[model samples]
Target: MLKLESLVFDNGFARLPEAYYSRVCPTPVPDPYLVCYSPQAAVLIDLDPAEMARPELVETLAGNRLLPGMDALAALYAGHQFGHYVPQLGDGRAILLGEVKNAAGEGWEVQLKGAGRTPYSRGGDGRAVLRSSIREFLCSEAMHALGIPTTRALAIVGSDHPVYREDVETAALVTRLAPSFVRFGSFEVFYYRNQIEPIRQLADYVIARYYPELAARAEPYAELLREVARRTAELMAQWQAVGFSHGVMNTDNMSILGLTLDYGPFGFLDAFDPGFVCNHSDSGGRYAFDQQPDVAAWNVTKLAQALVPLLSVETASAAIGDYPQQFGRAYIERMAAKFGLPPGGETVPLLMDTLQLLAQNRVDYTIFLRRLCDFDSTPGALNAPLRDLFPDRPAFDAWAARYAAALRQQDSADATRREAMRALNPKYILRNHLAEAAIRRAADHRDYSEIHRLHALLSRPYDEQPECEAYAAEPPDWAKRIEVSCSS
Candidate 1:
């Protein structure tokens, strides 16, 4: 029902100087086929979900053809990868297929990842494998459903073309949607090159599109830096609260809008180990579960440094100084909500103590949090299920007593507290084991039912879907066989 001619395209980033990006067309892949599509994402751009199955849609998605008014380009940027600064790291395997304004008049950029090699492809084949594409497609929608800010996937297209990573995997492409693909590294590239004009121009363009309110301010650019810092702090807090370990917290992966960007080697904690590292490539654990907040702060500091040319050094430093407290406050508030306590309440120490107990016991993070919703102020209420989760029963009992006491101090009814906690705690997360099961089925058997099923289940993560209870259970020992890395 959707017509490509009806869509309005705007090339905002391409309107910038040639140095900002390289105008290129995605290399056509042979025999393109549709793998899966997201109906929820389809509505965002006013596209009919039924239209996604059309051959024309598949062709456009797979880079075999272009939609009307499309102006494809690859963006240029730099990044600090695992503490080392890379002077030039751009969209090597992705092509921005221009921006489309939906019926609501809001502009969204449609990008095809793993399309083909660009000027930025650093001696590597620019193609995404089926395994990683499926992971990203599922996880992006899952993050959005969990009420976390992130880029969304419209559809995924596959091809018969062979791309080599760990194996000679078949190629695939994911159509990702975002307001802007600009990253913190977008500014860093110019600053490092001593090209102050491009940096200023990029900042001005970002302000005009994303932060228009700041455009009228006296120090719009400084305010822009401060706003980005605040959003990044809050985003990191959300990730920590949800037990998500973004394996690579590199500067390039940090979105200027603070949405979780570049979903590679990302994993939700299976157990409450703060030191858990999901990426096999992260041998040093630079991006461990507990280290995310600090890594995010460090990345934000790099962004602040890039803005020094536009704002006073003192102003930028002051903005960077606010990150820690901002992160601390946001983390405390989110964690407190999960434990059914008021923001900045007196029972914060009890919440911290409980986390330590969970970590010590290696309790399953998602299960333990969801189970806490059943806690009541009564003495024996939490003894059976909750206490059994910990090896040290006495330690857990002591913590439960404190938690019950804290609950008694509050005036809310038992049901009210339970409902609040349930809302904050999700019953489902995109577990690594579950993702692998789906991946194996798709890759080996060419069966994609599991992918569609997961997309449906994860879209309502907070709700208890009894029919899919097996998806919520803790991972078995065999599940540990699944390993993710930067290659993912």
Candidate 2:
């Protein structure tokens, strides 16, 4: 029940040296208005949902004005871009407004993406368009609903002011909330500069604030890298299980805290293609759907390299050496849960077979997995619904028989297993087609109803909401033409 005016503000990152960030104010926009607001995220910082109705709320979020507690600034960091080291790349469009502690005393940093120019703007306008802004806002909530760690979106503010990308688009700002906005690049920038003391200070700040348990360890810096590797591995497993493609896995985009930091050119599987490259700008397909795990491991290795000054080469390398094992175990365990089976090396073959079959036939990833929940293990129990998804029904039948036999080995009951599997495998994801539909409605006609509808639907993605059944359907043919770039 907190009001905007009543909320106390603090900037933890701002307490760092001046070189860590650039002081900046949000450049104002024209005729700012509220597009969508998330009450679930709002309550995280105890912001009253009622306060969203105030004109000042949109004004504050859109950089048209500021609340008494607000102190905006853009952070500084450098990162690897497409495996090449970029010496400087900070928050080009994102401005951290301030940080606030929720009722449970969990700190949440409030940031405005597309709030205009900063030192790291790199000669480009620090503006986010309506299309990309809406995608980030919805996917942030969608990922969170799926029990995945991600930065939360509080609200989106739109304006009549035009921003040019491939086409002319209206400007928008998404208010992002996170425990901390620090990334792997936050340390990489200093490490590459050979600034060892600043890197140590940054490491100390992170350990003291976020990973306090590691501070007591004999080798805290190495322990921190190990902990980050573990988290990144687990997160990659979740992303893979759910068929999500984070088209950009730059070190800067990888959260130091292991949350899904940046949402750009991201997609959920339509037809199962392991090499699905959602980012149109990524012609090289480096961050493909199936490549996420390896990419994450690479990013973590880059993080270890950044911390090389604090820890020995062998020490830093050893800390993250177990990343592959960690990722493998986590992914297999999740796949087992989706199949209502126990986690073991034995289950991996069945899991791999399921993926292979799905890919070979180009089956709709979400639908096939959800339908598998009802697969009857009993001999001669017709799995027509499951088999119907594949163009190659014979291939599916072979896979289904193996899966059924595997289920029998686990001694699972059909009804009990179906219920459990449904919980793990979502019926609805923030599909690119769905998001595009909502964005078109909002951008073209200024109709915000679809955005509200999508938000409500995605909030309970695991539920069988019969009224929203159309949303669970496969993508239409035209959806193939929908392209999302790095800018998105």
Best by lDDT: 2
lDDT of 2 by residue, 141-249 (tens): 9999999999999999999898988888899999999999999999999998999999999999999999999999999999999999999999999999999999999
Reference-based TM-score of each model: 0.98, 0.99
For model 1, the superposed segments whose C-alpha errors exceed 4 Å read none
Model 2 misplaced regions, further than 4 Å: none
Error of 2 at 377 (Å): 1.2
lDDT of 1 at 383: 54
Extract clashing residue pairs from model 2: none
